[model samples]
Target: MNTKAFLEPMGSWAWWRSWFLIFFGCAVMGTGFVLFINPYNFVPGGVYGLGIVFHNIFPSVQVGTFGYMFDVPLMIIAMLIFGGQFGTRTVLAALFTPGYMNILTRLVYPDAAAVESLDPALLLGGRLDLSNDLLLTCVIGAVVIGVGQGIVVRQQATTGGTDIVAMLLQKFAGIKFSTGILLADGSVVLSGLVVIGFGIGTAEAEPAGWMLTLYSLITIYITSRVIAYMLDGASYDKLLFIITDKHQELRQFILEDLERSATYLKGKGMYTEAMKDVIFLVVSRREVRLVEQKIRSIDPRAFVVVTDAYDTYGEGFKPLPDADTIQAE
Candidate 1:
């Protein structure tokens, strides 16, 4: 179990780039939690969601600190179950998010009074609190959080906690990943109902109420859509199937210029009974036109079929199962 090699990215440049993206994602997500979501107590899911619940009960403890309380144990569990395949990058994400969240909390709220003032309240006896712009805050905060999470996932890392729970459920219960995520997050959301409550206005105290819960669900939905869009959205990448006579030349172009490999399939034309070489390859949407142009140059009559590839994973693309998984295999 030499985890050193598995924990390290294949090359130095790649290692640094992955870390940069992971940290950047953490910062973005943390900022959203501190400035927008935390102020209003949205409880959007993850360890942070639980943090908000705890914060409501115990205002003295910081949400980010509570996140750490959940994350460290989850990290340990991930290491034990997934081993090196769980990756050091995931551990970094788990730690970076809460750490940065604490940093952002301090920067935004320097004193106890500022933190206490975040709850929904009235100003000057009759006016509503300006900071309680629920709709706009939820939408904007969801977008920010979604994009940040998408970036971290693109690096094949996670911020731990419930994500680990979802993975374990998927592994042992034969549950799909998406389903597992929904179930886990949905449970957290339901818990929020109890923590935040389902009520309207009260003269004595301001409760989170059912309305905030509904708004929280909206934010979660928006965040999921944004994450989906960032991850693979429509037309992000395409699978090209080119049937042409100039197979060798096209293959060479793909290998050399495109720096991508292709698969060649032998086929016979139905009408002419002539042999044909079908080339199957994938290219980013940005590179589709160039690849098409190259194909035209090589063979004017080549029949090309282009289809969307939502997500692609494998060597030369996404990494294979983590090092430990590969070893076990």
Candidate 2:
């Protein structure tokens, strides 16, 4: 198979824009990892999370170095298994993020010796010392990481790490993608429990290790929600099902006034045994009230139900994804 076939050609402006987003996203992700997640050793489940665990054991090695060690092999394996779908953008993001983190770490802790010590006071000159406020730190880190990841994902590229492992598991073991993510991340968190929680690395058992683990779970949940919100906006369209005698009038109102389309489903009333038309329509949240008012005006007794439509792709909505487009998530 020609790998080039999967690569989409872009105009100069779009090409620059895509690369900019990738670079900026990686930097943002690195910021979260180094400043918020790393200093206090909060394992949020990724290569970097594992890096934090390994860093506890090998203080000399930076967290980002472990990220590189894990990411390179994962990228190779993913490319082998999935082919050119693992494009240049993913490779750049995987490789660039760790280097950026290492640079940021050095900048954060100017003293070379302080890097290994993981001193909370030394980090950001004690300004961002959330040692007393772990929950706040977790929330900040998750939001920062989520925004960065969301930006990268918007460009249809991923910062390959455990995500590759999850995809591999899905392919080989028949595990669901989501389940694979849970398994991969769960193992990383569990390792933190053994290494950091039990004090295997520090030789000083941390009583707060379980609390940190719980906080990490909360971080993961918040990050996932933020990423979802970034991908799909906060507001969802409204879907309406209306059954009424004034079908023609409602249809005319929808078409002429609302300038929207609706589908009429032929139905039979269960109790009355009478034929009726069910008006099925999808409208934006703002237009929903207008639709309701119009419906009430037409027939006050019309049986109507309104629900949220999370994803609507059609002529007047989001375009369908291209068949050849590759989404690395």
Candidate 3:
């Protein structure tokens, strides 16, 4: 068989993996909404919270139903503008999530009045009955909900609804993604102020819904920042360079004492007729500190430069150097 010929193209496996990832990501996000926050009467940031607002304002409306209905027109617009991949993923998230949500909402809330929280911690720590306060609900709700969204993003998938729309708005309308999401989610949060014949606008009405909304925003912000920090860079390694006349002494000392590697560069001094050696080494951040200490000790006049490098792939940086050379150093 022509193995090389077959290997010439990247094939079906990539597409299958992408689909699996999309399904898994959506399931995790849907689970977060259904299991943790929905029955809790708290909305997390983004479209999920908007669904909460929708259900609250119109008690006859189901959040899952709202998600399903709201996503269709957006998906259609996205499909027409972006093409099949974007539209397909949007469709999958919108269709699958509403059923999960509707099922969960029924199981948790069907005529089940918000019973007094029997948990001692809730009774003691939360002064009022747990059923009524939006603050507590939002605080706890955002954590579960935000984590769900993070999992989908980490896997490079969408939770199906407004996430896709946010992305489209960012791409076509030149709005920032974060800004677009804030607008979409903020509108949902604002509607929460007027749910179920209660209006927070009055001096007497507690702004419980808005409290939860703010908490969700804070939680979502913190969660996304954490995710970005984790993915942005690996901070373990650094690069160093020394330009000096005592290159041989420094090179031998570094190579022998620290058991590290260095590259010597050939250079001509600007005025004097003298050759100089520029030594370069890649090592851990700790080693960079040590190297600086040693160079200053050996010759205070030696010029040095250091930089942060993401990773080193060969020799001492990543894969271990030959054991013999290491021991010899």
Best by TM-score: 2
* Model 2 per-residue lDDT tens digits across residues 83-126: 66445667888999999999989998968888997787899888
Using all chains and alpha carbons, the TM-scores for the candidates as numbered come to 0.70, 0.89, 0.60
Model 1 ranges off by over 4 Å: 1-24, 84-100, 120-133, 150-157, 173-179, 197-208, 225-236, 244-261, 268-275, 294-301, 311-329
Better of 1 and 3 by TM-score: 1
Q: Which ten residues in a row have the lowest lDDT in candidate 1?
A: 320-329
- Please list all clashing residue pairs in model 3, or write none if there are none: none
Query: Number of clashes in model 3?
Result: 0
| Top-lDDT candidate index | 2
- Which should have the higher lDDT, number 2 or number 3? 2
Candidate 2: Cα lDDT at 214: 87
Name the lDDT of candidate 2: 0.81
Residue by residue across 212-244, what tens digits does model 3's lDDT show? 556656645543443333323326588787887
**Tens digit per residue, CA lDDT, model 1, 1-329:** 22574556567888778778989998898887776788776878888988887777777788888999989888888777876645576787888898888776665554665564444341222133436578998888899987888787667667777767766776687664444555677777776777676421212223646676787788787776776666555444789989986778888899999899988888898999998878879888899999999988899899999998766777566554543221100
Provide the global lDDT of candidate 3 against the true structure: 0.57
